[model samples]
Target: MIDIDATLVNVHSEKEGAAPTFKRGYGFHPLTAWIDHGRAGGGQCAAIMLRAGNAGANTAADHQQIIGQALDQVGLGAPRPRSGP
Candidate 1:
């Protein structure tokens, strides 16, 4: 399974794509996907997408793209075929 989330990275210097976040800090918000190994707690990162700090967390387009990249990283293709009856 895969888990996706986003976090704000604090920045001390001016940089492209950096903006004010909800946390009232200047930085970049990056979305990341991780492979859940189950029972193991933490997992390996599958994909990361950098965005401006002001980017919305509930953006459907970004989530879809990130999910697709994560699936690809795990060797899964789009429109995965169903197995078992």
Candidate 2:
């Protein structure tokens, strides 16, 4: 399984993709995906995309791209077929 989320990274200097976040601080918001390993312990990160802090979290296109990249990083090709229960 894959878990994805974005976090705001505080920045002290002007940098590419840095913008004002909801917290009124200038920084970059990076989206990250991590694989779930359960009892085997927390899994490693599969993907990360750095975006301007002003970027919306609910963007569908960005999510799709991130998921595809994450799958690739985990040795799973994008657009894999779903398994039936």
Candidate 3:
């Protein structure tokens, strides 16, 4: 399992002050669980909580992109981005 803080730091370092620019700022944490793989027994699964602001269009889009990149870095691939809540 990967630590959320570490992933965030790696992501932040890649961008130029992009972390703080998040609409309402942001926080993420990943939870790991074991899933049975039938004959193989069990494997790892993750649930990520990515919290961000309800900012304007451009800022929100940018932050979403950043988060997607970060997830990709850790082998998570891109998230299914949602429209506003």
Candidate 4:
């Protein structure tokens, strides 16, 4: 399964996409997707997209785009890692 999440990153200086965050800090917000491997704890990052700190958290378009990017990154068109030793 794929789990998507967003995180706040603090920036010390001005950055191209950095902006004031709700936490009253300046930085970027990045959305990321991870492939879950259950008890194996072998999850891997599927994709990541960066947005300005002020970007809305519940934006549908952002969610959809991130999911699509994650799918494309790990889709059948891409080779999967070897499953066995």
Error of 4 at 85 (Å): 48
Location of the lowest summed lDDT over 10 successive residues in candidate 2:
76-85
What is candidate 3's lDDT per residue for 1-85, written digit by digit as tens? 3322213322443333333423344433222222333565554433333432222333444445555554565577845768788
Looking at model 3, which ten-residue stretch has the lowest summed lDDT? 1-10
User: Looking at candidate 3, what is the lDDT of residue 85?
Assistant: 81
RMSDs, each prediction? 5.4, 4.9, 10.5, 8.7
All candidates: TM-score:
0.85, 0.82, 0.28, 0.81
lDDT of 2 at 33: 83
How does candidate 3 score on lDDT? 0.40
- Residues 12-76 of candidate 2 have per-residue lDDT tens digits of 99998799998899998889888885787778899999999988888777787788889898778
Higher-lDDT candidate of 3 and 4: 4
Clashes of 3: 0
CA lDDT of each prediction against the hidden true structure: 0.88, 0.85, 0.40, 0.83
Clash pairs of candidate 1? none
- Ordered by TM-score, highest first, the candidates read 1, 2, 4, 3
Q: How close is candidate 1 to the true structure, as a TM-score?
A: 0.85
TM-score of 3: 0.28
Best by lDDT: 1
On residues 1-85, what C-alpha lDDT tens digit does candidate 4 reach at each position? 8888899999999889899999999999898888875787788898888999998888777877777777787663454353335
